[model samples]
Target: MFIKDYISKDYPAFNASDSIEVANEVAKEFGYSHVFIKKKGFYLGALSQQFLEESAEGTLATLEHHYEKFALLDDGNILDSIKLFHTFNSNVVPIINKLEKYQGYLSCDDVFCEFAKYPLFSENGALLIVQINNRSYSMTDVCRIVESNNGKIYGCYISAFIEDDVQITLKISSENLSSIDETFERYGYNVVLKYYDDEKEELLKDRFGFFQKYMEF
Candidate 1:
């Protein structure tokens, strides 16, 4: 998926000449936290609601904090855009041409909708999560291991921890869980835990108890 597939054609935008008050109204009317600010149909940055509220200066263009990096979309796949969105921890990404002309915007909702079409997890498959110390943690080792065991890794996710380590989540479909576990363990990845839905009744009960208490509160 790319911005072409997920960006809303009707989404609101702003221009440099637009007053800060006008931007605020657009944000309020559309219920958007930020609006794409453009000039001569070229992508500039963004004007956020927080920027407006925190700014005492009435000048919209003079507000230095109103500027932010536009989430540039080159000729890339939807998965690539998803990675960028996650890396930046941003909700909206601006699409642009090679010459840096503004195209449109992609929202976080669109990305999740695209991913939800695929499987996030599966009980028929063994899920393994590995923790490492770098974002560049290679999946080649696990991919090779799964293939060697006649298994298939359906998807993978790599994230960083606050303590400088990285966390990898993998979804593997296999007939033998023990073999997969042994292979991952051979790679020095500590197995945190393992489970199947049939074995999760007790676990669900404990979790539900906590959820019930939280709901009551």
Candidate 2:
């Protein structure tokens, strides 16, 4: 989703000549990691809250050299903000135009709200985390495996990379989770983590009961 409409101006962007005390006050008020800096309608960068505290006294002008240049362009997708949030360790991301105009900002809370609207989060489903070799993995095969087992995939994505294997986390709706897990294994995928109801346990109990009866013969 394009972020043009989601731009928020609730967080103040201080001018370059703005007082350090005033800037710090606004930063503290908003509980943000950094306060945006702008001059002549163009964004400069950001001054971290910790640096603002150390500043004690001075104008933003004095700390121009310390500004951290990080911003998301206006054309960026909402998903893009997540990476920037993690990369910069900031709760807020500044938005700017291609011509260097300071537009507004996107809050971490707002981004999450946007995410919660997507099927990956909103739909009811069982989640699975499976591991596969990087060289042999195919997204097509993953989707095929789940769908062939009478499962409907709400969403799935590669969640991690561990040495030679990558873990894919999937949110799928189905009651045949036991069969799905076994199917993944048969297709060379390791079902490392799975979340579901008690169907698997019930199946195990029934199998154990059958084993005990057979032993009595």
Q: Rate the local accuracy (lDDT) of all candidates.
A: 0.69, 0.91
The residue pairs in collision within model 1 are 1-78
Candidate 1 lDDT tens digits, 80-133: 666656665566677777777777777777777777677554234667777655
* Cα distance off (Å), candidate 1, residue 163: 11
TM-scores for every predicted model = 0.70, 0.88
**Per-residue C-alpha lDDT of model 2 across residues 1-217, encoded as one tens digit per residue:** 7988799988889998899999988899889999999999999999888899989688999999999999999998988888889988999999999998999999899888988998889887689999999999999999999999999999999999999999999999956888899999999999999877456777999999999999999
Candidate 1 contains a number of clashing pairs equal to 1
